[model samples]
Target: MRRSLAALAALLVAFSALTVGRADAADAVITDFGVQAGESDRVQTVALQRAIDETSAGGGGRLTVPEGEFRTGALDLKAGVELHLAEGAVLLGSDDIADFPIRQTRIEGKVQPWVPAVLNAKGLSGVRVTGPGTLDGDGKPYWTAFWKRRAENRKCTNLEVHRPRLMYFESCDDVEVIDLNLRNSGFWNLHVYKCAGVRIEGVSIRAPHGDPPRITGDDQPWDEVSIDRAPSSDGIDVDSCQSVVIRDCVISVGDDCIALKGTKGPRAMEDEASPPVENILIEGCDFQSGHGVMTCGSEATIVRNVVVRDCKVGPGVPVCRLKLRPDTPQRYENLLFDGLTLDGAQSLFDVKPWRQFYDPQGMAPPKSEVRNVVLRNITGSLRSLGDLRGNRGDSIENVTLSNIELITDRGDLRVGEVVGLRYVGVVINGDEIEAPDSE
Candidate 1:
């Protein structure tokens, strides 16, 4: 029989070199389904998440976390799983907060509940978490109870400090998280919700060196006070859901590196609940220590086709921010911030809306709107600057600032509108005003 078909093609090339070869799915090996290397096993991450929930309930595989040191706690990834963290693996995170527990997740989206994730993959479909190991969220007791409630209530609620997140994939589909490092987390450090064909490549998220915590009720008294302590730390929080593609990632944060959300309102457009975030694509990324390198909505609801191209922003954050929350039926349409490199900032763009200590008791306060925003080719330089307020009653209309070359030290450019508008390329303190062309 042709030597039994050449010994079945040499046993499929020795079972493809004992797993872990080229890709295209088909790698189902998990160190014999229990993974181990150098001790500290919480039964080896619960026997490798029960062998990836019994091989994705008999229809999937590939959940290997080889290499070493895996002091586990919360690692739940199912649905045709594919979490391979070989090459010196680490997966540590057990600073014990009940070793993590608090289900029904979905942050920034309107599920209003979280907790559970030191790497979680939910309601999946072809989910993946490639190699180049390390998913450590050993956040020193939730960064010491978020600085003891920011030294005693200066306004707190990151779920009242019970942090735990270093990878949270929700309502997923065809997801792929490549080359990882994802470190020090106790909250918000790669949280994607209601996903679809999402791909986050070459990741490297870090955290350490805490010294920021002030958050004191907003509504402009210097708007955002403190709250930058890499504690409830967020560095990639895409909510609602969409066809996402965040390329070559690298974020240094204590808050907001990329936050575009949706789904929060009178049940947020009810379509049987959920679904609002739209086609998002954040190109080649780079940001350092949070506060808007790319942020939108305060708790978004209808964000549109967002495309932030070739990026890089550093030093004293805030290159472009629009946190509208006049209660919460937000809408930031067709946003496109092209080829950017604002190497320093304090504000290049900021739209307002946050009705003082906002309260949408039963929803119906948010009438927030910011239309066709496009900040093309931007370069930067700014210090001790802030405020580009627009909301004399739901403002920020059809903004288009092209070839932005900023250099501000409060060098004025504070234009406020609301009376049949038309404002363009404004420059204050160096005057170049040309607004008032509307009838």
Candidate 2:
């Protein structure tokens, strides 16, 4: 156990952020339970589930999946069981929606009946999913179906088409997800909801990158076709979760790379189930080709005390993005982004209203507030500078940018209705704007 903790510190971080499950010993192996390594029309998850159940039912330990290409439906991860995939192992999600049973899970900020993720965990503690392996969500079919639905109605929500994420942990504590290649997710790659003391480290998340072709025929082999923008395929969605440390992850996804989410509605601020997301630290991560490197909401109500530091943003990504919902009452404060090195990004800061698939439930729209936000020590070159705008009744106060040096392609910066905004040692496009000049 001492050796295991030492190794974990080396792999995840030099300083330990959180302590997870004890999975040093393997008590069961999936292949030992007559599980084959290929495709089948029937749900192949039965053997795997049996192994997990037997191992966890008795005193819990690690359950190993050996090196092979295994296909399965949805699976439930029990408490005290660590699903460790060996090197060269590949766990593929079945394309059949029927294989995934409908379960009550959170999607897009609401808890409703949806397809469970490839791996699900609920109301458990000391859970860990780690190993140098791959979890592939054969997601092209879902993407094709989503585009088709959008074409017909143009207003269909993401939940209209059932898509499964790679992994989902709900109401779990002391979780650690590390050292896995999670790709081609039908929806968000990793969704952590209401889970505390979570540490996500050294995982690689990739989504479809091909150019999206037009959806002309339903009978066409949509799976074989190319779709660059995977619908709702965010890399990491931390929903109403706290005490999370996301470090050393490499993310290149179609949607936002790291998005903070909470419930969204006129009365979202009063929603007890979806509490405020606070005390998060995101550090030493790499982002590429995502919508926003570090973003907050299309479905956030209250999020505070978040710090993103020492991250790198590749080209075509926005460093910071805030999606303020006009229909929901939001309070996002005490957020800080520091020591970010960006290269050729789209913009430094992008904050605007997000109204897609927004329904007010016929109630009066509520106002939002953003305060005590800071972005410091950010060195980057971006296409455009920023567009930070607030809603008419919204309040944005006490925002500061310090030690920022950047060369911009276009100096089109727009700021509106911000009180107590300040900049220190900021240079944009060879122009310096210090304390008194940038008030």
Candidate 3:
């Protein structure tokens, strides 16, 4: 184990050296471009873009935003550029949809038309966003729009509603996002798509707690809506990415704190020839008030070799989740969750079929598979042991639970369609189920 940790550390060091070595020598401050804080009608978008473009044109360097609230629209990032926000700096997103131009991007594993994010970096290398500052998405308008749309159509999907994300990085290499407070996103907070050698550290993401904002169209005030009205406010979503490391982050949002996904179905299968998401490492994180601490797949083609360790999940946060949609072809394997302390979660491990948006688009339904999952050294207070249900002839296989202690009201371990299930030193309320019943 020691040797394995050493090797991992060495690999991280090598990756950092390779990526950080490409940054330029000097820093370019945005304030030098006549950006001010006190003006009511001022939008820092143009000024910030000027700084980034000039820096990139002059051989990429750091574009620094000093301490102030700078309202901005979509700011496209360039290669070899680092966006640094100083302490007390707040990069506020404009609520107007016009500020975000429509672009072709990947959402839910398919390429489609979508509003560009507040900060977008595509096809870039050695890009970084680091600072103790904040990126506030100001998502109230978009959230209201989504609720109204849902009211009209009860079965509307996420893509049907138009909203912009906080930060979106696509097809980028050697990306690093560190020490930033990302809050109140209109959609997913941080989305890293089809990126490699990514490292996200010391980030804090939070959405509005309590109730969703109320719609004021029918004699109602917007701020009084129930918190449940907030939709798709995910914390960090890593989609079709490789060699990713996320550590020391505190996340609490309306949706999953950390979600991993791949291609949706036949379209993704035709585009890619290999696994979509692989070699992901998540450690030393705190999760609170989310759908799940870590969830895999509503649309995944192949996700393999993921490790989650040393995480603390607050009350009502599921430790881990695996979601398989019948319409999407998926293969999830070699996932490990170790040293997790969970509290008041609905379940410790949740594996079930997802049927929220079940449109296969006339394609033949494909068989999904989940195999080789390990849960070790987990201590938690959960509502139940959890459920593992899979389709017939496509069973979940080789799941091992070791050194687990849980205090729960109900210890019923629902093992449905699982093969080679093993439990070692597992105790639930001072009683061991011994052999879990499998169907």
Residue 311 CA displacement from its true place in model 1, Å: 15
RMSD of each: 20.9, 5.5, 3.2
The numbered model that scores best in lDDT is 2
Candidate 1 runs further than 4 Å off: 1-43, 46-68, 71-89, 92-102, 112-115, 119-263, 267-294, 298-318, 323-341, 344-347, 350-366, 369-393, 396-439
TM-score of each: 0.32, 0.92, 0.92
Q: Which ten residues in a row have the lowest lDDT in candidate 2?
A: 1-10
Cα displacement (angstroms), candidate 2, residue 254, comes to 0.4
Encode model 3's per-residue lDDT on 54-143: one tens digit a residue.
Answer: 888888878888887888889999866789999998898998888888889878776788888999999998879998999998888888
Candidate 2 lDDT, tens digit per residue, 224-275? 7667678788999999998898989999988899999998989898888899
What are the per-residue Cα lDDT tens digits for candidate 1 across 110-142? Answer: 565557878788787767888798888877667
Question: lDDT (0-100) at residue 105 of candidate 1?
Answer: 78
Using lDDT as the measure, name the better of candidate 1 and candidate 2: 2
- Please list all clashing residue pairs in model 1, or write none if there are none: 164-186, 214-227, 252-289, 328-366
Clash count for each candidate, listed in order shown = 4, 0, 6
Which portions of model 2 show Cα errors greater than 4 Å?
A: 1-24, 38-43, 217-224, 434-439
